[model samples]
Each structure stands twice: as structure tokens, then as C-alpha cells.
Target chain A: MSADLQLGASFRDPSGFVFRKNGVLLRQVNRPYLESLKRLTDSGLYGELTEAGLLIPHTEVGIENAFSDEAVAVLKPERISTISYPYEWCFSQLKDAALTTLRIQSIAMKHGMSLKDASAYNIQFHHGGPVFIDTLSFEPYDESSPWKPYRQFCQHFLAPLVLMSFVDIRLSRLAASYIDGIPLDLASSLSSSHTRFKPGIGMHLHLHARMQAKNADAGTKKETRGGFGKNALLGLIDSLQSTIEGLKWKPEGTEWADYYSDTNYSDAAMIAKHKLVAEYLGAVSPAPNIVWDLGANNGEFSAVSTSMGFQTVAWDIDPAAVEKNYLQRRADKLMLPLVQDLTNPSPSIGWALRERDSLIERGPANAMLVLALIHHLAIGNNVPLLEIASFLARAGEWLVIEFVPKDDSQVQRLLASREDVFPDYTQEQFEASFQGRFTVIKKDSVPGTVRTLYLMKRRAS
Target chain B: MKKLNRALNIALACGCLLTICQSANAYIDAGSGSYLLQILFAGLLGGLYFAKTAFGNLKAAVVRRASMHKSDDSASHVR
Candidate 1:
């Protein structure tokens, strides 16, 4: 077995590649990229972006243990806790990532450098905002050179954002299909003609797509002959910024978005639920370092977990709810709110299906919180209790879950539209099913509500 | 005759500029052309932004210098 394992997703760029050695991730900067790397560091742009938290910070390491003979230098970047795909991001998260990429590019220009790639995968949400993760994406800016990543930026950022805002918001799922981005042509066709009336859509999307179609017959050339000046590049970035800033997706009228406001829980009941969850978390041993709050509507409980010094990922099915949760995540919050339908989670995608990990591959978190969600998975989605327990068992070592009885108004509401064929959906059955997977540690009823919250540890395999 | 020659030269120059500006090889996609066109239109906006930032900086510098001079004057009087 080789000591170094190259990351599946980082094969495109010849300048550098990320690899793992003894489970420690490191980037080997190729010899060809040495000039660009020096320009990036010596130019002070790296320092500025890293200090501003716009770029991921890295430390240079000795190349004696390089992954390849052509290695110029090795870098160890602060690893992002969990890697998320663009398709999983809410409208606001994608927009923020796009704007962050363009902002970094503009700043790079000021320091006589430019971004070589505009792939959405290059940006990751860190702390409370998007941070550029690929350190080798920068190259020395030439006044005569056009921005090579312009087309990629439009495809990855502009097209998807336009489709989400103007067309159906669910069109963002197209990102999962087309890993590069939602194709410009598809985005242009999906959106109504009314979208052309918007500030940047007509020119950037419709016309741009047409141009791409016209030039489809042309062979790929690495460099186009043109003298694209610095001012022009800056102007392009400004236009993109304005276009993204102008686009907005309001989370209104969604059943989940209005969940907290329309819930049967009284103000006191809500507080009681929160308090019980906090207390249960405190009782857990070895303090969980990472937490996954499944069905975390607006991240109320996720925030509690974050406050307790845990890196929490708040997953919700509704884009609107996820967007709302993300909006509340300021600089102090450690929550990464993402849109994820528990029923159909994000799957392994890209070449060989291993380029991107499925939701489960990235998980088995230290602790998993499934609050007000069991009824939905069981009663709403028709998932068997035993299966749910098995799935949750694979998701975490400790599980803090709520079992909303059939009598609960929320569960009744779910049954209102469907036949009540859930014969084994009783509390006794729920506990029995979980017995095979989890050792129930404690169970308590939330005050003022007919809901039971249970804390359980995974049974030894 | 001279005016005619100058007109011909100007037309040839314009033709050359147009030819060079035509969307480059297959390497540069249509999206790049559309983006470049947008940049050409918004170049003035970028300039305006720089101008606004410059003016703000100038104002701050003037305010800082005036306050510093006033403090120096008070210090000398006290001495």
C-alpha cells in the first residue's frame, strides 16, 4: 500500500493535488506552479485574504516526503470539518459562496494576481461564511490575459443563482446532475422570458448560453488570443457581485419555514423542549466534538449544541428553513446549516461515484439530534421504525431523539392526508426497534407538550 | 487627396480594431464574450467606485490632519 492517497476530487488541476499521508491531509504543489505560488505568497494577497478569513490558511512543509517527484512544496491547510457540495447549499449559502469567490478574485487582481479556477468546489463554508480552500488556484495576473475562469464562474455561480431566483428554486438540484454547474443553456431555457428583464440575466444567461451553443463546434484552446485589461476584469467582477446581490429568495409560506410560528407548542413548551435537550446533551460522556442536528428547523437546537462547544451541522429538508437557519448564523455561531432531505440524502456523485461522498460516508457523527423528526420519517415517509433505528445507528454514536406519539397534533396532521396503515408506530414498538441498535440511556417528557425526548447510546456491534 | 487618404487610413484602422475584437478562438467561450461586453459597459461603474473610495480616504486624511494640528496648537499653548 502506498503511503500517500490522492483525493479523488482533486485530479483536475495539474498545479497541485491534495493527498493524505498517515491520515493527515497535505497538498503537494507541483514544480510548474512554483512561480505562481511565490507570486501568491510574496505578493501579500495570500496574507490579506487569509487574515480577512476569505482564504483557507496553510503552512509550508518540507518536500522530502513529497507525494510526487515533481513536487515544489507541500502545504498543510486547516481542514474543513465536513465537505458539502453546492447542490446541498441553500440559495443564500450558494450566493454567499459565489460572492466570496468573486470578492477574492477582485482582491487578487489588486495584488497583480488572478484566480485560475472558479469552481464552486474551491469554496467551503467555514466559521460563518465562505472561505477559499484551494490555495494553488491563484496565478500572476497579466494585463493582456482574459480571466480564464470567466465561463466557469458564470456556469457555477451566475447560472445556478439565476435559475433559483427566477425559475423554480428546486432547479438548484440541477447542480447535482451537472457537477460543473447548472449548464448555462439549461438555466436559460428553464427560466421564463420575464427573467430576461432582470438586470443581468438577459445578457449573462440567455445571450451567454446562445454564444456557448454557437461556439460548441470550436475546439478547446487553453488560451484565447485577446488583451483583456485589468479594469475590464474588475468591471466583470462588479457586475457579477451586483447580479448576485440583487437576486433574492424569500422563504415564505413554506410549511417548514413557518414551523416554529405555527407549532402547537406554547412559548413555555418550546423553552422546556430546549432545556431538556441541553440537559440531555450535558449528561453525555466524553463531550461530543461533532454534532448533526437532523431536521433542525431554523437551527434553534443546533445553536444550543454550538454554544456547548460542538461543531454542529444543522440539516433540514426544506430549503426555506435551511436558508432561514443559515441567515441567523453570524460570526459567533459554529453551526453549518444545510438543506438535506433525510428521506433522500445527498449521494456519492462525480466520476466513479467516489469524487463526492454520500451523506452517510461523511457522518457517523459523535452525537446526532433527531428532534420532532421521527414521526415524519415513520408516519409521513412510511419508513419502518426498525429501519429508522438502524439508519440513525449508522449516523451517530449517541442519539437524542423525540418520539411524537400518534396523538400529537403534528402526527395527526401527517395522518390527515394519508391512510393510517402504521400498525407498529406505537411508543412500545419504537423502543423495541431501537433496542437492537441503541441502549436507551434516559427518557423524559417535555413539559407542557405530549412529546417524549429520549437520549440513547449506540449498542456495541 | 490628403483628406481622402486620411479617411481611408481611419477606415482601415477601424476595420483592424473590429477584427481583433471579434470573439477569439474556441478556447474563449461565448460566456466570456458576453462577460467582456458587460465589463466594457460597466467599466465606468468600476471607475466611479474607485473615485468614491478615493474621496472618502481623502476626507478622512483631511479630518485627521486638522484634528492633529488643533491638538498641537493646544499643547504649545499649555507649554
Candidate 2:
């Protein structure tokens, strides 16, 4: 197999590494981990977790599929359609992922196995809920040892959740900066004084940070104390679980969270817009397998694409809106709701800047829905219409976009706050700008509103 | 319940005393503090967990008994 086929993110784990062979993703289990892998299976942890949809199921492939001579076994795991990062998840999504990790840890202990790492990246939003994807994370449980992943779990999941809940929801973006996880020290420093009083936060964040600082210089002296018994470890997991479950962020106060109810669209116009979107989506030749609903407030329109059996991802900048959308579509296997700031989308980072893929690297989706979002980018953020058009062209092949005219109430509301510096922000100029990159396929005006919707295909180079 | 609480209090006190030693070790380099924290709180945490499990069992038993009593009443009415 070509060395270039190896995934950048899969190199951190020594037990196994995932690579692509003949375009099929395969994981090569190294010799050192063969015994642990056996224990994982023989202990029945793998079967139980996968059966409950808590773990990604994998099949052992032929040894000939190994990526290197160090390989002892090869396996092919289920592919997650879109790999999202912890930074891109909403408050509830991160909370759920944290709870899922703790749940998996507790279950693993029951079967004489434990997770060696608790990186949030190991969990993915698959089949409408979070599922642990790393099959090689399990190792033989050591009853006398404290949970090896205790610190990692706190950094990757607990710290971020606490910061988001008590401080500011926008602090979750810290995950993008600290890929290993937001440092406990940083989280502790940023936390409110009230958090210091909370038992879980006090112990896990504040006290944990202090301990790390106090022992920062201590050399590797052997732990000269009693063993951390099995009951103690279980208690640790239970405490983490209760702490996470107790933390909650109500999805309100954000401007866009109530966009649907606060919008100027009449009942007839809303229905017409939804109908037009479904019709335009259906008109795409050969049909799109994946659809991205950008600026998808509460995923009101994303449901149209999902209803048509296409895998749909609803991305909104506001955490409140995304949280609402996620809760509404939690059971819909075809729909995924995530938080994203399109202006500053997720960037490629980590070793050699290739470990985690940037937002654009994962896309050029089959189709993109840009409904009622142009004004926000053009007038609200001062991004030129041409630039917005070009960015969208690079993001997807087909575009179903709405052009809100200057007279539209939403555009007027946006213009209310700032100077109307956009003389070029007219409907004709919008069409002219987008037509350069996308050929206009069809256009229709909503019956009760002056806003126009267009079905456009990316122009051939 | 009182016995469980007493045991937990004793564990917490012991954990507080152990913190004075301040020396510990672990394989993972990033969180030496984490290892110490776990050692210090393990007893209290374990005692609390035991209490929680005991209370849960008590609640489950009460619910089961209530359901059985309701079933007996329904059976008498049916006869």
C-alpha cells in the first residue's frame, strides 16, 4: 500500500493505524496490541457496545491487507459519512458526546476492559447520535490502576462542557485551538467564581488544575501509595457522569434561535418556499446523495432534503439554533445538525497541518442550500456578493439560493444597525454576481413576498 | 444509611490527610496531578457510589412491592 494513504490523525495511537487501500479504509493492528485486541473481543465488550450502537462495528479483514510488516491483523470499520470535530458541535452535542464516553468507559470496565484514551474526536455524530469510532481504544482493565484516560476525559469533554455551561457558549471554539483539549488550567482560569463553588467543577477543574501545577516538576517517582481499587474507578466514572448530566445549557437568548417565529414570511410564502426548495432539490439530475443546508436556522428547510431520502447536514452559526435543530432531528438517521461559523469555518490543524481536515476539504457537497442567507453575508458582514458566490461555488456543485432584496424586512433590519454602504446589494447585481460562477437553471418569485429563489448549477470551468 | 454516611465521612477525612504527602506517580505525563487527585478522593467517591447503589436498590424494591400490591387488589376484584 502507498504510504500516502495513511490517515494523518490515526498516527497518534501505537496499537493501530487506519489507512486506505484501493480506496477502502482499513485499520492495521500492530503486534503489540494483538493480545489486547483479543481481550476486547473475548471479553464480549465489542459485541455488547456495537449491539447497542455505542461503538462502530468492524470486520476482521485478511492479513494481506496490512499496511506494514508490523501489522498483526487488519480490519475494515464502518465509515462515518462526515467526520465533525468537537469544536463544530453545539452545547448539547458536546454534552451528549461526553456522557457517551463515560457510558462506554463504565460498560468497558464491566467486561474486564477499559478505554486507553478518551479524545472527543473518537466520537462522531453517526446515525443521528454520537457513536464511539475508535475500535482499538480498549485495553485489558487494570483494577489497581486509576483510569488512564481520566485527565484526557476532563480536558477533551469535561472542561469544554463546564466552560460552555458556566462561562460562554462561544468558548467551545477553544477546542479548535487546543486539539488535545482545552487545558484544565485555562478552563479553570476562565471559569466564573460560581463554578468554583459547584462540587464537580471545583474538584475536576479548579482543584485538578492546582494539583497539576503543584506537581508539574515532580519527576517520575513511583506512586508510593495503596492501589486505586476497582470500586474507586467505578465511582470516578459515576461522578463524571452525574456531573455532565447535571450541566445544562438552555437554547435561548440567541437572535437566530427564534428566526422562524420572528421572520416576516407569511404562512403561504413559507409553504411556497418549502415547496420550491423540494422541487428544486428533486430537479437535480442523477439526484444528490449529500445536501448541506447552510444558515439552517432550526433546520426548517433541511427537513425537505432529508424527507427526500438524501443525507442532509444542517449547519448554523448560532449554537441555540443548532441546538434546537439537533434536538428536533435527534432520531432522524438521515439528518445531522451541527454548529459552524461559515465566515471562519474549521481549518486544517495538527501534525503537518493535516491531522483533522478543514471544512472545505470535506466538501464540495453534491448540493448546497443558501436560503435567506445572502443578506447576512453581504450586508451584515460586508462580504461582497461576488466573494460569497465564489466561496459557495467552491463549497458545492449545485446551489439553491434565495436573494433577499434591499426592501425585504430582514435586509432592512440588518441595514437598521449600520450605514447602507452597499449600493451594489441589489437583486440584479446579486444575479449578475452569482451568474458568473453558476448558470441560472430556474427562478421563481414567492407569491406573498418580493424575495426571489433561484436554482443554479456551478458553471463548468 | 447512617453507616454508609459515616463510612463516607471517614473516607473523606483520610483522603484529606493523604494530601499532605504530596508525592505521587503515573505513566501518563500530562496529568500527574490527576493521579494524585484520584488517590485522594477514591475512598470518598467509592463510599458515595456504594450509598447511591444501595438507595437505588431500595427504591426499586419499594416500586416492585407497590406494583405487587396493586396486582393483588386487581386479582381480588376480578374474582
Candidate 3:
């Protein structure tokens, strides 16, 4: 109600909206949507999904909370971190989130509640599962709510998953361009000519979209008379399930997806480097709940944070690399792996900057793993070392960073193709540049490699 | 296989925490592997037990939570 906290095109949900205050994220439950929340919670649907780890959990903020003036009751989530979008996710990530949504919907129906919406953005990677985050997505099932979000589910989840599987791996990014989900009509047209008739795609994508537009334009804003009874709704869920099951993308051998199995590290080195991070993390007083491992090649180092129960994202650039990391994530159900090119990270786009949180908005990771990443940005990407220092200062309270010198074999290869113009790239220069922002606490080098690792803290506020 | 995956993930999560106890090896550790395997079997047994007898225990708990809300959007529609 503050008229702030507005972002993207979230204005369309007449049900309610999400907001944050004093470092806690909360969703406002308007006066009208009370019944749905009661129906959902009363029926045991919320409890089951939470215990199964399929949805984000919320605690009712006592009435005395500040926003009490506006909200019926404020809810505080356990933890909030980088909220990536559908377009940001690799194909497997989106597909998994999609399937998890369907699974939750099926579970909800069993207990006499139904998901009022199926937007992919509602699901997030939490504790190695696709957790639903929207507290306002519930409604009492009368066999007539018409799955008010049926069309939305098609546009948001099924359509994108299908397009990714059938058309191109990059099509998921189209979600950024069309926040309401890639328009079904547009998705139908852009889809390959052959897919228009593929039973699931034809009906759900091509024909269903045509029918929706036709019905929408038919001047009937009122709920339809078809009255989808419990049987019909369950039937619809089964239909969607089969459609999703039939749509599959066998992981194509991508360049980065196959990276970890092909890295230069030996067994001893991987273990040693991993231990180094754990040892570094062990020194911090209060356990940090979030960590960002920038340049997390296939997430080996980032795994340290998740192992400690901190929500972590292992960000690498190459889609193939991310795909490979994601494949392992799928096989292992690990939550730490994701693909991001540190040099050209994700940008906020959509209705307003609110649709997607900017990199800075989503960060400061409580701690960060900037190992082997500084040299890439400073030397390979031509970013000033001081700027890198400033960026890291704003990103985390504590940092476990690695600085590779020009003499390191990896640095040599990075500069092999470029000019040797980095005059101030010495170890002394590195310390001086970062010392302005960070108090270097402890510094050590790996047993075999000449790379230097330092644990530093940001200048106090 | 499904229960085994969850069991393995939880084990590896725990194992990663205890990584200091064992030296880093090139392959997965034997003791760690055995512990995770036992979890796999145990997790399966637990999953089955829950599947057959899930609804009763949490129904009352959920009702208690919902009653806290003064929602009007059919929140209490479920009996």
C-alpha cells in the first residue's frame, strides 16, 4: 500500500501483491482474498506441500507489525535470495520448476484446494526443490473457479517448456520480453510448423490459444458455463501432466554442461580447494544464509555453501556448462548450480525494473566465493581492478577471493590472445586496490598452485 | 530410485559438512557411500509409511493454522 515496491507487470493480479520492509519480504492479503487463504490452509493443503518442501513457508506476522494498517496480516518468509526468472533459468531448471508446479497442483487438488495461478515465477529453487513462493495463489475450489489461471498456466509454464523443447534453447529468454509469459498466440506462430499439430502442442499451444482468443473476444468476461467439476479439473491436470511428460529434451552434449568432468583440476586439487573454502567459511561468526559463487564453473566450489545449509547459486556463463551443472543438479537434486556470465550478467527488464530484480538488488550475498574470478574481469574483460574491488564491497559482508597473477598458467592463457597491457596487475597492486574497500583478514596460497586466496571483510557501515 | 535420490542428496549435503573428517579422495568415499545407501533404504521405508498414513497427523495442525486467519476469500470453505 506504500505505492513503492511496485515492479514489472505484477499489477495484473487482482488478488494481492508482494512487498518488503525492514529486510523481511511479505505479501499483503487484501480483504477479498481471505476465503481462499482460509480454504487452502484449513484443508491441510499448505501443510502437506510445506512438509514435502514443495512450497515456500510463511509465518503469520503478529497483528502489531508496522504494516498492520494495510495488510490483514503480514507474512515473513524464512529466507529470500536472488529471485531468478523463467528466462534466466536453463531449460532443465525451467522444466523442473514446471513439473514441480504441476506436482503441487495435483497435491492441492487431493486436499480440496487448487492453484489459482501457474506462473513459473512463483516457483523458486529452494533447498534442492522447486518451492512455490506466492502466498496469494490459493482459492477455494468450487469446480467453477475455472482454474482462473488456466490461460496463464499455458502462457507461463507449458508454452515456454514446449517451445524450449521443440524450437530453440534460447526461446526461454522470450519470457523477459513478454512478462505475462510469451503470448500463446505468438508462441503458436513462432513454433515450428510441424509442432502446430503435435497433439499436446496443437491442442494446448496452437488450438487452445486460438480458442481462448476467440472465447475472450466473444465478449464473455464472465466465468464460462462449462463448470469444470472436480472430475473435469482432475482430468485437466492429468491432461497437462501427459503433455509435459511427452515434451522432453534429452540433454544435448553442450560445451559447458560437460565442463566439470573436463576441468584441469586433479582429485587432490578439487578436494584441497574445496576444503580451503570450507575452512575459510568456518571462521565466520554467524552462519551466513546466502552465498554467491561468481564464476562458479560447474559449481564445485559453490557446493560448499549449500552443504552448510546456506542457499547458494553457482553461476557460470556457458549454457552448455550451466546445462551440465544443471544435469548434475537434477541427478543429485542440488540447489547451488546455475549459469551466469559474470562479465555480462542478467539485466533487469520487463514492464518496469520491478519485473526482475537487478543484480545489485538481488545481492549482496552474505558471503561470496570470488575465487579465480577477479583476473577474468580485470584482465580478460578489461575492467579496472579498483572497480572490481568496489563491486565486491557492495556484494557481500565477507569475501573469500582468489587473485591470480600474470605468471599463473591460467592467467597466461587468458592474456595469450590479448595484449599484455595490464601494467598494475601485480600482487602488491591487487592488495592496494582492494585494501581501500576490504580489510584483508587472512591470506593463504594453495599447496601446489601459485594462486593466492584471501578472506576479507567490507569496510564497516 | 526416487527415494534414493532424496536420501543421497541429504547424505551428500551432510557429507559435505563433514568433509573435514575424511581426506579428499578422487572418488566418492566408501564410508560415506555406505551411510548414504542405508539412508536410501530408510528413506524409502519412511516414504512408504507416509504414503499409506499421511493425512491424519497434519489435518488438525493445518486447521489450527488456518483458523488464525480472518480471510473472507473462501479460506474457510474447506471442511
Show model 3 residue runs off by greater than 4 Å: A1-14, A66-71, A212-216, A227-229, A250-253, A326-334, A349-352, A416-421, B1-79
What does candidate 3's lDDT look like per residue over A1-461, in tens digits? 36335334355676666665654666667667777888778889989988988888888876555343545666676674567777767777877787788888889878877787788889887666578998788766655434556667778888888888888776776887787787766887788887754544555566555554444324332434343345545545544665677677765566545556765567887678888899888776577877888887777776677777667777777555566667776534435566566666667766656677667777888888898778889888899889999888887888999888888877888888989999999899999999999998889887578788899888986
TM-score of each: 0.87, 0.93, 0.75
DockQ, all candidates in order: 0.10, 0.33, 0.01
Candidate 2 lDDT over A55-128, as tens digits, reads 99999999988888999999999988888999999999999999999999999999999999999999999989
Residue runs of model 1 more than 4 Å from their true location after superposition: A1-3, A219-224, B1-79
Cα error, residue A27 of model 2, in Å, equals 1.6
State the C-alpha lDDT per candidate. 0.82, 0.87, 0.69
Judged by whole-model lDDT over C-alpha atoms, candidate 1 comes out at 0.82
Candidate 2, position A340, lDDT: 89
The DockQ-based order of candidates, best leading, equals 2, 1, 3
Each candidate: RMSD: 7.1, 3.2, 16.5
In the range A1-461, model 1's lDDT, one tens digit per residue, is 28889888888889989999988889999989999999998999999999999999998888875898989999999988878889889999999999999999989988999998899999888887899999989988877655678778888988888888877677788898998877777887888877755545655566566656655545433334353566656755765676688798998777799888889999999899989999988878889978999999999899889988889999998889998898877564578998898899999999888688899989879999999999999988899999999999989999999999999999999999889999999999999999999999999999998889999999999
Provide the lDDT at A44 for model 1.
Answer: 96
Highest lDDT, which number?
2
Docking class of 2: acceptable
